[model samples]
Target chain A: MRKINSRQAGKKVPDYLENNIVRFVYLLRSEGVRIGNSEVIDALQALQYVSLENREKVKTALKATLVKKAADAVIFERCFSFFFTPPETRERLRELRQQKIARHEHQIKEAEQVFTFRGEKMNLSALDKTVYAYMPETEKKRLRDFLEMNESRETLQQWYRPFLETLVKGRLRFWHKQLHKEIQEVIAQRDTGDEELNAIRDAAAGSGYGGRTILTEDMQHITRKELPQAAALIRRMARLLATRISRRYRYSKKRRLPDLRATLRASVQFGGVPFKLKYKSCRIKKPRLLLLCDVSGSMIRYSSFVLQFIYSLNAVVQRIESFVFAENLERVTPYFQQGQDFERTMTAVVRESGQWGGGTSLHSALKALMMRYGDELTGNTTVIIVSDTRTIHHREAALELEKLREKVKEIIWLNTLPRQEWSSYTTVAAFQRSAAMFPCNTLADLEQVLSRKFLSA
Target chain B: MFVSLEKLQKGFTSAGYICDEEVILTVYLALRLEKPLLIEGPPGVGKTEMGKALARIFHTELIRLQCYEGLDENKALYEWNYQKQLLQIQAGRVEGRYGRVDGDLFSREYLLERPLLKAIQADRKVVLLVDEVDKSDSEFEAFLFEVLSDFQVSIPELGTIRARHIPIVVLTSNSERELSDGLKRRCVFLYLDFPGIEREIEIIKARVPQAGERLTAEIARAVHHIRQNQEIRKKPSIAETLDWARTLVSLNMDRLQGSTIERTLNILLKSRGDQRVFREQIGADALEKKIRSSLV
Candidate 1:
């Protein structure tokens, strides 16, 4: 007759939303809206920092970063205070939810008009800036021709850069980032005063500018702030692959690919048992990977990025020896056998990792690891290091790295910095003396190192 | 097929099954169509015994494949007779025909067939019970799909043997992890539930012939009343209802009284917590009135 209030009238609810903070964060995982600890903590921290006066804004703002996608954000908000239910209550809740959905459908129509107006302004902005981002301007001919087919304020603005647009909310940030290099190039062109414009004219052979910027946006060398390029960047890495293919093809005495002569010769012994001759050795060689990450405060941003990179690369690598280092180093190799949860795995990583935000001195850590695992790294091994070379004890640790580098076949260091930031206390720079190349400090550097330095090598 | 749902309606009325027609037909068609029927629902519903009863009505051989973790083909399918093969080799060498005779015993003919192959090759119609499949691994689930989809076996030495007729395949799952789409698409899905009080009264009277009509009805009413609660660990299945009815008959009781439920607690609930929870729900007075009302 009455609905059982298991959550208890929520006297603690606004307080739960307000005080008893349990923020439910859902990661826009591969399957669906998967709640992860990063989203949960972001929602929790957003509650603490943001005032309750703007509840809807705080929810939207928190969910924008915490939830991975717009669709997931809607689910995370609903589950944030979702109480347990008995079987009897499900039908009633189903009916009420359907009714609410019908009402929201109407609200969406009205919200859509406002949404569309904002969309038209964004289209005008994109068409004003990049000619390609705009609809083809048979526009003055038809009303629909002026706007994109999927034009809604949310869809149109973010459609320009789907990877980044979906990450933020009602406001478009990283907007300045899109036009950053372009503005700088335009300013440089103005100083050169029509010389660069002549290059565009020359490139176009005196026709109207086809309107691509003279500075080609080479996606092959895009930096790490764009996480979406991680896939494309990894594919361009040829040397890493050449090394893998070479090592994989290299045969052991015990293992060999099917020799046609060997199989045919053996077939005659069985008096032409052609059925037995069908079995043959195959070519399959996957490499074992060993990864060392620095999770000290300086490398926190790059640590997550690199771990995710290594994890995504698991389809190629046979084994990844994953380790996280701060003041001390610890192995989390087995934990990543199943793919990473990114934030949750990193949090478990940071919690048990023993030395997070502690001090760092690679000499003691690497020497300890060298004594522990010197034999593990042989001629076949490839060592990938993800860290900022700002070691706590710079000079001594640089010497330790030199000693460790002798044992491994190759060391690839991914440093998170612009080229301009690399001039200062460079432990990674010093560590590079024994490595294949000086540290790649930016995502651009990572891509360049992958393409030119490693792959092409 | 399973009475075609339209035909199942008349069959249910005649059989006094008093439940949803579609659900019964799905169970029926899964048998008739020769596809594994995966029946999922809350316990105390007759999910397990339905296969047993269907085997009875159809006069077919029922081969049960009980599943558990780490159950490999060696245990589930057929393992070679290592000792017998060794003895055959010794005996064949004495006769100087080692190669020719030992090979025949190792062929598909001499192989020990477990439930999976037994169900396929039965002389009569077979009802294969792949019970508790969720406890098995994903690899096993995939392996099962290959065999179940095609009722055939291929020995490396001998070629494949297809089933002479499509046998009845019934697969039951408790819904631990979502089954692969490959497996679900190969079968009919049916969700069975515990019967309501009125239907359960009729089931007790039908299955438990020894119990008096008044006593069976009282036991059925008490069982339904207990099933309504959510907190009980294991619901009293239809088999349990029959067990409870037979217990009263052995006690020489003409009617189910307050003391009878307490004495025969095991017949109603298999688990300890379910018995305790049921006792707490229907206190002293209701158990007394159970017999008093059924007398009418």
Candidate 2:
């Protein structure tokens, strides 16, 4: 057998080391890795089994005891390395912090110089920044704190959009609009020092200084890099949809009569007449979702977000079969099952399907899709088509869609086009006649549309 | 009981099990604190083997409970012997002695003990391995709280039967579904990934002793490389590495080469798809070259 390969091999651990381990466990917990008191006790006892000098052994031991899930192992490993940084690295980190402080002080001095410049023309007091500067720093800080408060409040309103208007105990929309108007007027009127301030604002926006940034009305404005957040929001919305739909369906229908076998078994003492009736609770057969996503050039921007949404929904409800189409269709149901990262899964999907780069041919795509996977759809299936419906020069595949609608419970089309522009797109109007069309131009649209159509019904 | 974790590690090593610090530490803590150790890993990573090894170290009987879908408390815990109860009831009625014995029939004499109950009621401490617990439903997972947390089982008829000896519980899961937070909160969670190359070599030499050192190293290295290839479905595990080494020794190969690997590829790769993927992607020559480079 190999002997313990560390300088402190067979050495007893001191009491302070256990305290350090406990603190490390709490650090892991604060980083959103779930760890319990049992794990802390285990870690303290487990340190006896391994040499502290042996970094790899200590890491593996802590990981085994602390991390429960594979996804959490990533977080654990990252925090582990940071927590156990080497002595030299600690010194280097101190030096880096000093340098960062110096740089921050220099940048602040430059910012103060620019702001203090009294521009002779174009009165700058109308601007929000000049007005904020006149107030105490505490007042400005409160404004920032209030903005932080509104961010979470805005997220809550995103979930309950319809009810937010009536519940007006704490509404800050008027104040937000006033500040935004002042900022806009400042930008509109050019002053002597305004260029430097505008440059500073551009830099802040580029680096994402959250406190100073103005909130846009469109809550669904997500960049390509924000796919992960968008995906999480979609998952939350999917769960909300599932619960709402199930609860509504459960209450709307009548329960079946008391189960005879159960009643007889329970009523054996009472000569078969049931004393406490066991009603046959209706088992809600979850509707199977079959998604047909358009992946042409026009719909490529919205397709990924839609696919992530569908994938998260599939996670909650397992009865979803997804297919992607451009000129032809390919079943992407198996890709989501792999549980790989969204980017990697999408890359694989793109590589496998020949029609990923082709034009949108709705007639041919739907015909081929029905020819292949039409048998998979039952009366309990909900066929969801996620596309802009901008088919180029092809006739509205109404016959195939009508046939599909006949086979499934309902055919719902998620149009990526804006509501005003939907009239300009002739193909979408034609398809809307065959199926129910809902505008899904953004992430918020998806939540509203899903709630209005499925849950409300 | 073992004096320390080092002693436990030594005992396992002497028993022909190559355990890393993680396994040794977790086993030690579980024994010391009397908490159930929840071990999760990909299949065939010696999760079940670790439980058995710990049992040997403790010198206790290993009671295994394999979990599957729809597994309930009836199968896991004690169940009543309905036939005996019914017969006794019939005899009581014949003798006209059944005035109001409402709860007398539901006694310990009519209880049929399963693995879980047997472990709890064992005379001495035993190793209770709840293997592949993720296969069981969430309701059954919640049902385990009474036994897992307090070392007692509640029967509506008998109130609660506490454990005679708190068995060293070892729960393993392949993470088929998310386990209940209540269950996780009670146990010390441990995740065992695949062993490193050197550790795997030690395991191979211990299990397949006839295989020479050179052949053992080569086989371990090949298995390590195969596992890194994400394209191959069903990566070759440590057990498969041992089997491949044994296969090579049985064929009387003094050293490993491209041809030897090609002939015994079936032992390493389980599926035809995996075999084809290995042949087309990472061929025998590539594996041999890696082994040679590592040896140098």
Docking class of 2: acceptable
Give the C-alpha miss distance for residue A454 in model 2, angstroms: 15
TM-score winner = 2
Cα deviation in Å at residue B141, candidate 2? 1.7
Residue-level lDDT of model 2, residues A342-413, one tens digit each, is 567778877877766578887887788778887778887778898888876446576677777788888889
Clashes of 1: 5
User: Which digits, one per residue and each the tens of the lDDT, describe model 1 over residues A320-423?
Assistant: 57676778777777665655443456566556657666666666678767888776677656777776677777778878777777777677776654443465
In candidate 1, what are the lDDT values of residues B53-169, reduced to their tens digit?
A: 656655577889887765767667665554455556567778888568744765764577888877877887777888877667667888888888888877675678777766777
C-alpha lDDT of all candidate models, in order: 0.55, 0.68
Q: Which ten residues in a row have the lowest lDDT in candidate 2 chain B?
A: B97-106
Off by over 4 Å in 1: A1-457, B1-20, B287-296
* Interface quality of candidate 1 as DockQ: 0.02
Each candidate: chain B TM-score: 0.85, 0.94
Candidate 2 share of real interface contacts: 0.27
